[model samples]
Target: MGRRSSNKQQGGGGSEVAPVRLHIDPERPAPRKLEPAITALRRGHVIVYPTDTGYAFGCAISSPRGIAMLRRLKNMGERDPKPLTMLVGSLADIGRYGHMGNAAFRIVRRLLPGPYTMVVRATSEVPRGMKNKRQEVGVRVPDHPVCALLGELLGEPLLTASVTHFEDEQFELQEPEEILRRHARELSVVVDVGPLWPDPSTVLRFLDDEMEVLREGKGPVPD
Candidate 1:
């Protein structure tokens, strides 16, 4: 019973489908554990992992395989466009991924380092999951360390995918270990480095100096 081996409940799905899972983790970043989590993503598995804002279900943002797996598990409609959010390791990547300005900076300045999602233009490397109905994408740089570390280790932005396990769940997990085991085989890895926020990031669309509230929870948007 190594920490890396979480319990993966066999979710019910079509015989040909792989069940999506949720994972919890220990309080340390064991390379042994992280490697499995990363492997899960590399293999196209959908996962429920913790982030700065809360516990989000996500996949490797650049992997179509991971995105498709999430789309199937989410039972999203064709017209849904499969939009997802990118969790960048730092503020620098936001420019590489989207066009930003003083306005975008101000908006991000207040809400970020916490729970907030900013919609921006899609770069060539962005995953299809983040694209809008017409190909736009959302990006976030969380104030949490574990998430940032994971992004750095992966050498890419993280995809903030959604899950419905808990009703109105915030940006943190209470029983991460159990969660990890519940979705063991289905997850990339579970990293519970330390304490984390228990809410989701404030979500906003910032483009051309305008702002729109996609979701009104966690961090609030100013008028």
Candidate 2:
């Protein structure tokens, strides 16, 4: 069996679709729940859950099967994969995932723990499934307890970010318990820390030569 398992209800032009739900405050240790969440990803499960900024949905970086599952969830048809932005606990922890220079470091230090996603070069350790194919990756530092708790427990940088299964809008599912009830079979576990903001993280991509604002949202990273 592939790493991902899904049980979705399709409502489209004769296409199979998976249901996306929210899990809010379940009866489990935040990290214990995270184990299954990561397990599902390792086994190829695409999930949508809460984040510091809003809700982050994606597969586990360590799982190529999960990456393919996420791609299918995103409906991506490209041959090579493009790196997606991910949330990290802090700047120090991201050393294995992407490259953060002094300038990028200064900028990220100023805007993270608030709401912002920084696009930068990827390190060799970046997953081939998640890297831009050219060694570039987008990274973020979230200032929320659940975000830290999950990272602390997992002991690895999770590729958590705000992405939608459907196009034309950002993927924002804010309820944890509801999500779990709907797709429990699809996921091994769902972490229900608590309610979080209903907003998405702000996006900023740092060019080799300069800084460029990609998408503006809740958290305002300064110049």
**What TM-score would candidate 1 get against the native?**
0.74
List model 1 lDDT by residue over 1-223, tens digit each.
1242333343221123333322334334445445555656666555666765556666777777666666665665546753567788767788788766787677677666677777776777675555767666778887755566567667777676654432454334445555554554445544444434456556787666777787776776676
**Displacement of the residue 27 alpha carbon in candidate 2, Å:** 14
Q: What is the C-alpha lDDT of each candidate?
A: 0.61, 0.58
Q: Residue 119 in candidate 2 has what lDDT?
A: 74
What stretches of model 2 exceed 4 Å from their correct place?
Answer: 1-30, 33-35, 38-44, 79-82, 163-186, 193-197
C-alpha RMSD (angstroms) for model 2: 6.1
Error of 1 at 209 (Å): 0.7
Model 2, span 1-223: residue lDDT tens: 1122265543111225433232434333355445555554555556565566665665556766556655554555435454566667777756656666677767777676777777777777777667665567778777766666555665566676453332246545456655555444444444445554467667777765367787787776566
- What's each prediction's clash count? 23, 17
